[model samples]
Target: MLTHLALKDFAVVQSAELAFGPGLTVISGETGAGKSLLVDALGLLSGLRADSGVVRHGASRAELVAEFSLADAQPATDWLRENALDEDGDDGRHCQVRRVVRADGGSRTWINGRPVTVGQLAELASHLVEIHGQHEHQALLSRPSQLALLDAYARNDAERRAVAEAAGRWSDLLAERERLTAQGDVSDRIGWLEHQHAELERETLDADSLAQLSIDHRRSAHAAGLLEACERAFAVMDGDEGPSITRALRQARDTLQRVAEHEPRLNEVDTMLDNAAIQLDEAAVLLDRIRGDLDLDPQALEALEQRMGRLHELARKHRVTPEQLAAKRDEIATELEALRGADERLQGLDADIAAATRAWQAAAEVLGATRRDAARRLSSDTSALIAELGMGGGAFDVVLEVLETVRPDPQGAERVEFMVAANPGQPPRPLRKVASGGELSRISLAIEVAALGLDAVPTMVFDEVDSGIGGAVADIVGQKLRALGERRQVLCVTHLPQVAAQGHAHYRVSKSASDGVTQSEVQALGAKQRQDELARMLGGVEMTREARAAARRLLSDAG
Candidate 1:
């Protein structure tokens, strides 16, 4: 329920604070007294668009705050918790929504004093209150909103859950089918994969084989040059001409040994020469062994080249580097395995689709049955209400048309349309086409009152719902509004004294000017004051004796 509304510089409402309570609270005054300004302020606080023109002439900005008590609003509390906007408190349950519009055409919204986006505020406000008026009635004309309203009234939580689950399962199965189907012909791909696997298996190039092949290829590629270089080195190290450096170093060492007694440095030089001669001899032997091992194998080199060429070709065909060939091979192998199982997977998907279809059909059948039953009851109840509201001969019907294609949706395949016949023996037609503005208001009120018994919103506002009719009709509307107040907070703005007389609390909007600035103020009316206000409503600017007497009678009858 809306507990308090604080307005500052909003339109003609310069600065006003109105505290609201439970039951039917009516706002009444003469025309152009800025009664609608109060509704506009509440609208802004309820997440409606804000206009900069609403700011007072001398003020820089306009502010509107609406506070709601959420003690009985468990659905709203759960919604807040789901959105991570739940307030933290052990003292009590309450939620406050505030909106501020700057004179520069900028606005900001807040919930529980925490900054929030306009969309978030709107989402939260939608669950808190619903405003009905001449212009707002179009919300009911939408088909989707109508269906949602019906579903809300039915409270079909189980069926709704079933539909959602079936939709998710169907989506998942369809996605998997698409993925497997994109793999193309399994037989052809598997054959191609087998051929590639065979080719790689035949070559089987291990690390040792690769290393040996590289060595043999290098030797074969440079066979003549290597042999010539080895011969030249061997000859230089051990060829005749004085028995080479070995004999010369031996002779020098013997002479140095004899002179070592006189000069020890000569012994060191002779030792170095002997080591050099031994190293040369070892080099000659190594060169001889290398020359012997240098037989070129052309066949081995050709095989190595062929293997490397095939690897390169495969790399190019796969659009990968040679190093990635192994990984590509593994990926292709896995794909082939999956391809081999595609038929089984497809069969499994077919089963899943069938299962989902059956599940959806069952849930839809149950939902359709429930809606039909509820619609019958709703139509009869609304017809009774319509008769009570002074449309005695009117007939109301809730027509349900089942769609052929049963797509899984939160609200089944039922299309609900309200039909009406204003007189007996006349065929019923769509309510929007058959009802006038005033009749539509009454019909909407009837449906709202019936639906209100099921909806969870804590507050309901009707902006002149009692318009275009008076006397007993206005009284009946007031009675229904008061009856609705028994379950939820009801706020009504009206011009009818009959309706105003039924209010548990009354507020009067009056315009006043001070210092050349006009503003609107709202004050709660006392008993005598309400009598005068209702009398004025009955007799215009002057309260006549007859008008006062009629106002008193209306109030007495309302009580």
Candidate 2:
């Protein structure tokens, strides 16, 4: 429920604050007193588009703020939590929405002090408030909105969701089957993929195999250079031709061992020379082994070069690196398998599509049954309400137009249209074509009352919804709104005295001008103030004794 609203530099309203409570709260004022500005502020907070014209004259921007307690608004609380917009300290039991429209036709929105997009604000506000403008009867003319109202009245969320899901699955299966059929025969494509996969499979494309192949290729290409280096190294280290390293080391060790008897330091030198000789001998043996392993075979080298050339050519052809050939082969093989089994899959899809169609029809039938039941009850109740609201012989009807198509439909198998006959002995026609603006308002109010505010939105604002009625009918409108307030918070903007007198709380919007600057102010009236306001509404510019007495009678009767 909306607990508070504040406006600053908004149209003729400059800095105004209003607190609201449950039950019917009425806002009344003389002509051009800005009575509807409060409703406009709420619309902006509900994420309506804002322009510079809404800002007060000479003001830089217009600000609108609304606070709602989420105690009874579970959907709103869950939305806030899901969007991470809920405040911390209050356990998300309160929500504050603020919007500012700049003079340059720019606007910004915030929820709980965090900046948000207008779309997000609108989505959250849908669970918090529902506004019915004076012209909202136009919405009743929309077929989808009408269907939504019927479904809401039925309270069949699960059933509607089931129908939508089944329809979606059916549609998807049909699209898949169409695509497969459109492809005609894919044998040629399948043949191409099979050949590509076979060609790739002929090569060793694994990472380890490719790496070893590269190493062997490099070694084979340089085998001549390696053999020359190994033979030269072997002769220089251990060749017996002249003054070899091994011969020199042995001579040095023998001289050092003889001198070790005179000085112990000579013994250390002797041991070092002996270790050096052993290391040189081992290195020479390794060099001989490497020389034997080296092969200068040109044929082996040419084979490696040809293999590498083929890998590169394949990489370019496939638009991939040589290392990716194995993955590419697997991908082609999978696709080939799918294409080979295309005929079988198409047959399977036909069966699946047929089954899905049956499922959707079944779900839609169940939903349609629920709607038919709800529509009957709603039509009966609305007809009674229409008669009570001064349309004595008026008749209301809900016509379900059942569609005779085999295709799955998310909205069920039928559409709803409200029918009405505003006069006795007249044939019923579509509400959109037969009802005038005022009659539409009354009928709209009747439907809402009959539905008993079944929607989950906690707040319902009616802006001048009672515009075209007076006298007893106006009184009945007020009573009906008050009755609705018993279940949902209702805010009414009206100029009728009878409607003003029916409020649990009353507010008067008065306009004042100074220095050619006009401003509107909203005041929550006390008991005496309310009476005076009602009296003024009853008697015009001046309050009369008779009007005051009548106002008192109204209050007494309402009590």
Candidate 3:
């Protein structure tokens, strides 16, 4: 339950703070006193959109903070802890949500003073509060929402989810089966795949071999030039002609040896000349070996070029890199295997889809039966309650239509709509078509009260639930709301005295103006103040003695 709400510079509410407890808390005020502004403030705390339009004049931004105690909200507490947003409080039993809207229309959110995304705030708020706008009842106009409401009332959530899962599985298998069937003939597909696989199999496309082939082809293409270059260099270095480097170095070493007897430095020079001669000889031998290894055969060169050309041609045809041809071959082979087994797989999918369809149908039947039972009771109870709220002899019904679906659907196979007839002999029609605005509100109130057993929301807020009714009928509306408050925290914003008198707590909104600036203030009324406020609501602006007495009697009877 909400323990506290604080608003800063929000709308006509310049600044306000209120502490709430579990019960029916009522907000009442005179015309244009901004009673609904309090509800709007609460709405902002529950992740509603905020903008500068809601900010007070001359203020930089609007701020809202709502505090919830987790003593009875284990689910919300667990959610906070799981999300790592429960950082400030030690016991993990307190949650504080705050939102700030700047004048530029940008907003920031926080949970337990730690910055968070607006989505996170919205998600966590679901476990904390349910803020029903005056038009939330308009959701009944949608068929999907009607179906969801029925399931909620039936309390068949587990069964409905199971049916959805089974239906999804069935739909997936059916799609797969249809795709395979569209392939026309498995025999033709397998024959095509096999032919492609055989064509790729005739050539080897290994990465390392392809690279080596390219290298060898380059060498073969220039084999004659390479051999000629090496031979020319070898002839220049070690030729039989006059004054070769080897012959000169040998003569120099002989002359140096003769002079070595006269000078020790001459011996070192002779040693260096000998080392140069040995290195030149070894280099000449390597040159000869290289010339011998060169492939000078034109046929071999032509064959290597033809092999490379074939690989390139195949690559262009397949639209892939030469190295990827191997992978493509493997892929084709796998598809061939699949086509060979297509008939077997089709049989398996058919069996699985059949089983899934049976499971879904069974669950849908059970869910439909439960809904039928719950709907009758709900419609009867809500219809009977509406008579006391000024709609005498009205009738309400839940129209559940079974549908024939080509394929299984997630929401089981039915459409639901709420129908109503206001007069005794009138035929029932769709609620949206038959009910007026005020009647919609009242009927919505009736359904909300009747479906209390199914509402898991911790808090329920009703804005002007007593919209159209008055006199003795207003009293019945108040009593029903107070009874609902007995189970969950109920907050109501109303202008009716009877409704205000029935609240466990009452707040009065009064507007004040200074310097042509208007602001709304909310005051939680004490016993005497509540009596006076109820009197004002009962007897207009006058609040005569009889009104006060009657107000006190209403409060007493409510208690």
* Best-matching candidate per lDDT: 2
Evaluate residue 412 in candidate 3 and report its C-alpha lDDT on the 0 to 100 scale: 78
Model 2 clash tally, residue pairs = 0
lDDT of 2 by residue, 1-559 (tens): 9999999999999899999999999999989999989988888888777899999999999999999999989999999999999999899899999999999999999999999999999889888887776543344666776888899999889999999999999999988888889989898898888888988988999999889989989989999889877877777776644568888888888878877899999888887888888788788778788788779999999999999998988899999999999999899988988888889999999899989999998999899999999999999999999998888899999999999888999988999999999879999998778546667777877888998887778898888877777899889998999898998898989998888888999999999998899999999999999999989988987889999999998887877
- Please, what is the whole-model Cα lDDT of each candidate in the order they appear? 0.79, 0.88, 0.83
Instruction: Give the runs in model 3 whose Cα sits over 4 Å from its true position.
Output: 1-23, 31-137, 185-193, 228-293, 339-353, 380-384, 387-395, 421-427, 434-439, 453-463, 467-476, 483-489, 509-528, 544-559
* Candidate 3 vs. true structure, TM-score: 0.68
Model 1 agreement with the true structure over 464-534: per-residue lDDT tens digits: 77777887888899999888888788888899998899899999999888888877889989999999999
TM match of model 1 to true structure: 0.69
What global local distance difference test value does model 3 have?
0.83
RMSD of each: 8.8, 4.3, 7.3
The better candidate by lDDT, 1 or 2, is: 2
lDDT of 2: 0.88
| TM-score of model number 2 | 0.83
Model 3, 435-478: lDDT tens digits are: 46667767766877788724555777777778878999999989
Which candidate number maximizes TM-score?
2
> TM-score per candidate, in order?
0.69, 0.83, 0.68
